[model samples]
Target chain A: MARQKMGGFNAGSMADIAFLLLIFFLVTTTMDTDSGISRKLPPMPEKDQEKSNDKIKERNVFVVLINKNNQLLVEGEPMDVRLLKDKAKEFIDNPANNPKLPEKKITDIDGKYFGHTYFVSKGVISLQNDRGTSYGTYIQVQNELAAAYNELRNGLAMRTFGEKYKELSESKQKLIKKVFPQRISEAEPKNVGGGK
Target chain B: MSKFRTKKDKGTPPISTASLPDIVFMLLFFFMVSTTMRQQDLKIRVHVPAASEIQKLEKKSLVSYIYVGSPLQQYQKIFGTEPRIQLNDAFATTNDIRDYITSEREARDEKEVPYMTTSLKVDEYTKMGVVTDIKQALRKCNALKINYSTRMLSSE
Candidate 1:
């Protein structure tokens, strides 16, 4: 009787096996990341709650309407989409202290703007779109509105903290947000015009 | 000339492939970790609109996707060219959203139910009527947190 020793297992094919697995993953892998405009829809109104009409002043509400033709009507006036951000920013900030823009409430935020009462805009962007409006146009309008708020917050953060809003400490960011809160109120869509 | 001739004769000593597997394994691990496998085959064509102000959807495990788009060419005969909602792998109507939400909620940890987000990956060209219906359905089901899934638009 003779005992036989096993030769070293061939690892020459190991590379081939790994290559196969690598190719499989490559085929199945989806590299695109998910990103988007996050929003919180208002909770369904109770039967009684729907009847209660807490009126918002006309000056404080910046009405943005999009029609089926993708036309932009801002505050009852037709405006170009390119001009929406600046218009929104002006409505929110009201740097000139214009009486026509949204009224600002003086609040002591107790931060870098300490002791000084900062005027927080009490503005609400009311967005209403026709049912037949294209999703692309709707998203574009939403983007512009969001960008307006972001720029305002960024400007405030830079002025107070000398940094971007995203770079600031949580509390500091909160203060800036308190000054320029994102208050986009989406109204129920209406069939203002016809489209498929 | 003599040095060059000797080096050529040795022929680079077969260029050691001992680490070939290691290299391939490294690449394999990278792909495995950095990307997610395609979860469902798309039944419709969805070209998400581009937006300048966008936030990355965080906590992917707590996110569920609802696709809204017109049927692809092959599906047009059966599903028609009209835009429709696709939940999971099957075509669904707005009415089916509640059940879908319920099932999706039940699939996750109870504590995480509140944190769950419904991402709407709707086509850009689709009319808002269908999207509005989806939103209303989601609102009724109390799935308030939503992300309008979009790509980044270059700032002009």
Candidate 2:
């Protein structure tokens, strides 16, 4: 055999192919964003508003409890969800109705009872899954609460303009939304077990 | 002695690579046109649990909700004490979840500034994969600043 010429194999094209693949995947893979109910958090209460002297004294606080069966208990009363929305709307639309308000404002209102400084706490849902409550039932209760919040917000929106909610002017509608935040924020972590 | 030359170059052969760039361009166009553009996928279905003691959130006009979950199945499965659709079962449909989220973002972004934030309330039992799906979808839609709702009382 004639003296063999030892030339290394050219890998330039292989590098080019690899580079092309890198670009391909980079272009093909798409990133996703958080997909959940769009909720705006209430701004921090003013420093003065947070004065400890005010003490968030829990009074007439609406205690709505959701159980593993998705049943709703408003202040220990088993109320229909539709009725709950109307009741909640009445309280939120006019805080004056919150019974927890100072006795003066509570009495000032035409009725003896009125809504108070309502602080719909994040954990207020209080989902108590019984020993055998399936995860599915728990989810249903969650959905219903979400719907109620939406309904309450929508109803308040309607009340603001005394018209169908969808027909309200954009600004007026927005004003209502700012007040409700769709009333759906992030769900608090489950308290897990307890009936108190 | 005169060195033997291979066949004297016939009239300079026309360079064929002048069109090489055009071929590359055509190939690029073909790939772009034929390749299915991968849509950003959400990792999970996030169904926010609702609260009875729900505070009315203000400035809701500036917020948007994205439902990330198994796609809406036409049929409902009555499995347990309460009626709840199964989440992310292999057969559950999820095609619209992404599109719905994308459209909501597009619609809201058009009317409001980009300052709007998204709050995610995923069911505790939802799989991590489903949550990823939701996040990927949100990123594609250009939504940011996800908030998780939690109870101060529970940990206490």
Candidate 3:
């Protein structure tokens, strides 16, 4: 019996194995990174933190509530998310300057002047959610709210600084941010109208 | 003269197959390098909700993740089916969140601390109870930069 020595290992199936691994990775790999709603969390309330709710008038407070049903209630009335941005913008800009809106025009040393510039600190958006609210609906509401602020800032930046909000210099961007500081205040999740 | 005008068939010339492995190897390396392994073997099943508007969280190195979802199948018997929070590699209650945020901040350069952000990857259907608690804890730690992880969808 002649024992024939085969040279090393088999390479016949190597390509098949590589292709299998490549396909596995190709299907599972996620190059499109996770994106999100970037928000600044409010600091933990201090023991002596002053409660200033009395200072903000009813018209100055744009209260948005999301019951467990994922339904939106802007300023105590049930509203659809579709109408949220405009309602929020109207409230923030107070285009009508109807003292009824949470918006107010004030002079700031930043130098940019406008006919209907709302005082950033005067307008407040208080958002409350239910314990049973779906994250998707909650996020959509947040996106609409944030989009309202972004558009306002961007429009103001375009008009005041001759550049988009994102394209402005750091100092100029800071000024815009200071003027329309994001003030989405979250309230405790209430067990409003959803399942126990 | 005819040889110049007419092509001679050497019984169908064989195409070179030598570089096949090299080409495939190049692709393999590219994927291997670019592919980020599933970090923090998720104890909770997090399917981030979809949204129309999204912002990219800048400074990848300054970002940390907090996942919230119902317990996985095996752990359901012990941890129950209720949604739970997972910080880094393990499941944790809200009590541990402050520490987690502090440790994550501690890992960063001092100057970069202000730029650090926490990405909350909460499942779409998960209750917001746990999420609110985590946020409160994060706020106490002054890790106020929060990014609610969401998937981007078109057509509203």
Candidate 4:
């Protein structure tokens, strides 16, 4: 057998292949993932309500809690996951319990509320979760909260105008949605307090 | 010369036909074993409030965020780089939030028409009142979507 002379090691070829593989993986991967629950947040307030101190103080508020163990607490007491929707509805409707009708209002040329502005006010939804809970559990809670709000909002629209929420007149629905509190504030667990 | 000077090997040393395949295989195997798969990464940890009926949002940007923590009440700040305007200050008397949103909208670029997608990242121990106050502020933005950020559960 003839002895064969070995050539120089081809470092460049190995380098090229490695680089190509690295690029392939980088491009193929998906960069973003769902943080958890997806929700359609309510719009910001309109002009009329902008100056009413009275309306701000007396508005309805809903409270939700998730303990370190991932257990739920509505208001102050522990609650079953099943009660989430009903509880949300109950809280949302608390505002409408008031007897007074929405006040009358006059607007400027830009449709901005000039005088006293009236809106069907939906109260705020307050959420608080413990530090130790998992993200999945948190998302679960959020979904429930939104569902409760939607149910309450749609129910009000149907009862008040005798029409489905989507089919109702835009102006009328807008009025209804504004008063309906779609805002959610995540409270600190320390202040969640004792159950009602 | 002793038996014809041992036949000298000619041409290029037997081209490493197997070397390329072996190198490629080793490279592929390394990546397959060593590459870490990306997963959901949440900036803040959360234990979401549970509900029976769950629905996904149509648009991701529209969802609002509210973060809650014990000491967070005193902090009164937004996470990351976004500015912190206290919830109480924003929603204090009347609808001050409405004013903030309007100003924000005006300052936003006209071309993008960025309909301010909003959320509040609250601390876990935040007071319900403060949350309410913040929510009150968000109501002023009139954003179409609202979502709280949370981490994913491990399969274990």
Which one wins on lDDT? 1
* B1-156 per-residue lDDT for model 4 (tens digits): 654445443434555554664676676666666553443233433334433443333344333333443322334353433222333223122255566456555766665335445554444433344444455556545544445543443431
Candidate ordering by lDDT (highest first): 1, 3, 4, 2
Q: How accurate locally, in lDDT, is each candidate?
A: 0.92, 0.45, 0.81, 0.52
DockQ of 1: 0.75
Tell me the spans in candidate 2 whose CA falls farther than 4 Å from its real position.
Answer: A1-36, A41-53, A57-60, A67-72, A77-83, A93-163, A175-191, A194-196, B1-156
Any runs in candidate 4 off by more than 4 Å, and if so which?
A1-60, A95-122, A160-162, A167-170, A189-196, B1-110, B116-156
Q: Residue A175 deviation, candidate 4, in Å? A: 1.5
lDDT of 4 by residue, A93-121 (tens): 54446533222123221233212344444
Worst 10 residues of 1 chain B by lDDT: B10-19
True contacts kept of each: 0.89, 0.04, 0.67, 0.31
Docking class of 2: incorrect
For residues A26-86, what per-residue lDDT tens digits would candidate 1 score against the true structure?
9998998999999999999987665757788888999999999999999999999989999
Q: Model 3 over residues A1-196: C-alpha lDDT tens digits?
A: 2345655455556667777878788876667586898888767778998887756677778999887778888887999998999999888877766867765546463544533444654788999998778787888899999989999999989989788998888988888887787888887778756544
Candidate 3 Cα errors over 4 Å, as ranges: A1-29, A50-54, A112-121, A160-163, A191-196, B1-14, B29-34
Tens digit per residue, CA lDDT, model 2, B1-156: 233344344456655444444555555566665554453333344345433333333354554443334333343232222222222233222344456546555676565646666555445544333444444455555565554432222221
lDDT by residue for model 1 (B1-156), tens? 998898889755766677899999999999999999897999999999999788998899999999999999999999999999999999998889999999999999999999999999999999999999999999999999999999988764
TM-score of chain A of each: 0.91, 0.40, 0.76, 0.52
Q: Candidate 1 vs candidate 2: which has greater DockQ? A: 1
Q: Any residue pairs clashing in model 3, and if so which?
A: A60-A102
The positional error of residue B56 in candidate 1, measured at the CA in angstroms, is 1.0
Cα-based TM-score, every candidate: 0.92, 0.35, 0.80, 0.39
